[model samples]
Target chain A: MSETGDGSLSPARPSRGMFGVSGSSDTSGFNGLATPVHADLSTPKPYGSWYDEATDHLAEVFGGFGDAIERIVVDRGELTLHVKREHILELCRTMRDDPSLRFELLSSVSGVDYIDSPRRLHAVYHLTSMTYRRRLRLEVATTVEDPHIPSVVSVYPTADWHEREAWDFFGIVFDGHPALTRIQMPDDWIGHPQRKDYPLGGIDVEYKGAHVPPPDERRSYA
Target chain B: MTTTDTPGTGASPTDPFAPSRDTTEGRIFTLVGGDWDSLTDEAISGTEKMVVNMGPQHPSTHGVLRLVLELEGETVTECRLVIGYLHTGIEKSTEYRNWVQGVTFVTRMDYLAPLYNETAYCLAVEKLLGITDDIPERATVIRVLVMELQRIASHLVWLATGGLELGAMGMMLYGWREREVILEILELITGLRMNHAYVRPGGVIQDLPPGAVDKIREFLVYMPKKIKENEGLLAGNPIWAARNKNVGVIDASGCVALGVTGPLLRAAGLPWDLRKQEPYCGYETYEFDVPTRENGDCWARFEVRVAEMRESLKIIEQCLGKLRPGPVMIGDKKIAWPAQLALGSDGMGNSLDHIRNIMGTSMEALIHHFKLVTEGFRVPAGQVYVPIESPRGEMGYHVVSDGGTRPYRVHVRDPSFVNLQAVPAMTEGSMISDVIAAVASVDPVMGGVDR
Candidate 1:
């Protein structure tokens, strides 16, 4: 363990940086002092099993596979294609319609905000191909400043609610969505609650006005 | 504004029964008084397309689902669903807690199928930790046992609620009775009747207690007869048949397009059961059938669910046969919490003897315990999506970690959330009454939907 900026020891391998509420309130002294922890666990060529074949087919069908896809990660025996935001819809349509990659069912669409990265907002899509009995994930990254990713509701109608949910939680705008309204949160609710910067809206546990502070800010007997 | 056809055209400005002349969307009627005559007159004259709001609170809409229906004389032209009335932000809360604490939060999502939610979330965590292979065989068996039991319970609830909504109240009683049998067995095994956070990241919170296996076996014998009785109460009844058959007709293609799964998709005849197709938790070793039906309607869903309960019984029986005496939690000391726990007169608490031994000799053991409970074991930084076949459908957890004790993000692809999208597709062309049957067939728990 090496000393951090505040003269506190910070462990080097497999960092435990983000401990408390992510912004200035973080007193756990674990906030990332390292350079870029998640640089996309990019797997190399011959990415074992079906991953290599899938990428080959994607490259064959969609021109500029290198340009559209930023990296191909095969971690935990799952394939994640980190694609550019502009090509998300194009990639999804090809994935759905192409004979080689008929990922007909759009299983889920989720979002993650990596606050440290320049392209902080990531829209993650999980697609399943019932025919091939295979699963593939597509991720699209965008800057928080311009968090716009093309909608894939045209190709997979199921993505409509999923996209709206991503918009509701992460504030990632899905361009050309039928009705991009707040889904899980109220329409009048103000900022995205799931982003890294958003304060976890919490209250103290209370009974008859006697309360214990929220867990993170509580005193510890360590 | 469709001002061409306005009932209560010349009423007092302050009249309680006066129908406000609004735009083409539809007019708003301020009927504080019971003006039945005026209401009928207004309904007959005030535009052919009448917009009726069913509920954020209606009984038959299956949990806080609001349907905005555009009806043209009993025929629904358009049906739109308004959900999000039950959002608890469980996903956001998981990011704040340690990895093990996440079970309590996730188990509350799909309340009826709580074990499935926990198993799915835990499986994803295990996969992320790369300890999937290290999990003990007994734990895998118990996980499967509890999950299949939850499947039966959840399907029984669907049967109960679906029957009650369609007017067969007797069937509802029978369905819930059988479900109670399973829930009792579950309460004995896990600690609660519902939302049991029994399944943990490494393994189950505890192993099956004494007589739990016998009780499950007893349920295996009892439920098949109960399912048959339930089928007898509804399958032949003319009103029940008429109310259900061809009511919520969503074809296989429709199911695929709308991302609907579980029994609804199986009833549509694709047989896309994740338990069979994507077998996790050693489900491949267990013998069970994926029941399917061709009608793709409420009756078809009813048939599929009943058949599935019998299959769950089969799997539960297999699980009982497979249970071997061994450790339930993993053996790795650093990963496992409280290394040893004792049951019986001690009332299922951590072993005091083990604690004493560790405290007297090993400072490292105390530190390991302290770090584990306080700040969970660090997972390698990456993301993983693990989907399991929940009673509603494919319930998945998309978990991302920044190599930390707490998860970076945990997003649930709740099947209830996805299948609720098919409400419009099923109910739009059908009559106003059929909307209830359509939604009941979908069987969405709003807790999962709005979570």
Candidate 2:
């Protein structure tokens, strides 16, 4: 339960590195700025036109899985269902098979590392229902120690490469993936490069009598 | 001794084909170890399979794309696509820069359709700022115009490369010749032929230059005739028809299952276009049709792309009619760029009048410019995903901001990446020669795929 500058419990610990180097000068000028970490968001009922009906239907259909549904968030005119990690597979199957919630096309599967939260890794799935002309987002989060989520390839075969990509960049393990090798990086490369703590590996540039520091080494206003 | 007495026979362990070689380097090995008659009989029996790698560096792959194929004779038994040779890590680099600088990074991802990338990213930023409605009418119209024009250019590249792959070299020449006209128009407006970071957050970088409209009108009159001639060359040719018809077929169900969209999905008989279904950037007002085909093969994709170019022409004509003179950028000085940009001797820069005002007389204008340029305006803490139809398919940007000048995380769901997943399914059982047609039909720009 380490606390950040704002006194909120953050899972992310301050690294010994300065902008990714083990020991370097801290050139980022952030004394006057405050980094705003987002708290969990929730919306009130009657959440616009199609949102209310969709949530009500989801709740009615998955009545048996109590507390598996953590929360339903409607923000920026989009609906998101934050489900527990264990029940994500069942939820995806139900969402894909249900006639009312036929999200037939899995548009994207992306991973976001929220290093400040208890569940440090988040897997976001964007599902598109061409039949109903609607879109839904399903998210599941897990910690670094136990970053395992069931593969939804059985339900959406398109998740094969996407799951591999997520695993490649975020170090989130998808259990039962056929071949979970790196898709974007070299197979022998070490460390997930997209993590918040991972340093942006940029080198200083020397060009035409001018010297420019790398992005991480440059002054930061955040 | 009698068997080894053949001419050039030397029973060398290092050279397996010692008996057949006339020169030292001419060691030609055969699959059959013992007798040619037995190997020929076995080959005729159809039980041999070989593995071959097509490219990460061959022509006709459209870019640096590698395909590994398992062939039984000439027919392919299995196909595997190996991408990531062109990985630029643009998304990871975007995290370190501010929001305003992100446009330059994203516009390079799908190099064929740079406007779609900028529009999607800007729309997401505006959504996070809750200023979707505040964008000026002229800006939106210009966005629609440039995006449609980009679509035409992208489809023409697809046509040109696809034609070259299928041995229709004349079509390749015609397609590029027609596409050059559009690129000149783009350069006239945006000042770059490719990777034009013209579309900024609040609006475009600058209003359209003079005579740009007349040039577009000239293009509108000239492009249709060229498209007709190009189609006439390939649409009825027996060789082209035989090469494309029923090759690499994926039906509507398969397309949905594999998350394929755009011309690939439309060619599969589903008219699920994001512009028509979701209607971003006031696309609903523009009258056009979503061209579709029932065949869902390489030929269908080719036909759909050509028809789509025609439809884009219609949209561009409407945009020409809808053009009105007004402010392009938003009035809000806080979020909008402070300087009005103009083409200078070196490159594009702030206009002389604004620079003079800030430098000489107006201290307030100087401070405003300094603050806006140094630290960009902050967006509210939230996450949003905005999808727009590019020439390839649905291009989406999932932007997360933590109420800072820089983005927390940004992930681009590029259509080229998603549609490339269907290559294995489409080319698994097809002939080895058909792989070129299938990959070209996908029209994957590897910049978008590997980014």
After TM-score superposition, what is the CA distance of residue A7 in candidate 2 from its true location, in Å? 19
lDDT tens readout by residue for model 1, B50-135: 79999998988777889999998888999988988989889998887878888999989889989999999999998877789989
| TM-score versus the correct structure, for each prediction | 0.88, 0.89
Give the DockQ-based CAPRI class for model 2: acceptable
Per-residue lDDT of model 2, residues B347-409, tens digit only? 878889889988999887786677567656666656788999999888989998766667788
Candidate 2: the clashing residue pairs are B55-B66
- What is each predicted model's overall lDDT from 0 to 1? 0.84, 0.84
DockQ of predicted model 1:
0.33
Q: Tens-digit lDDT track for model 2 on A1-222?
A: 001112121112232221122232322313324253645645556677688788788878976455887766777777778889888888888889899989998999899987777887999999998888898898899999999999998889999889988998999999988888898887887888888877777556679988898877789856
Model 1 sits at a Cα RMSD from the real structure of: 7.3
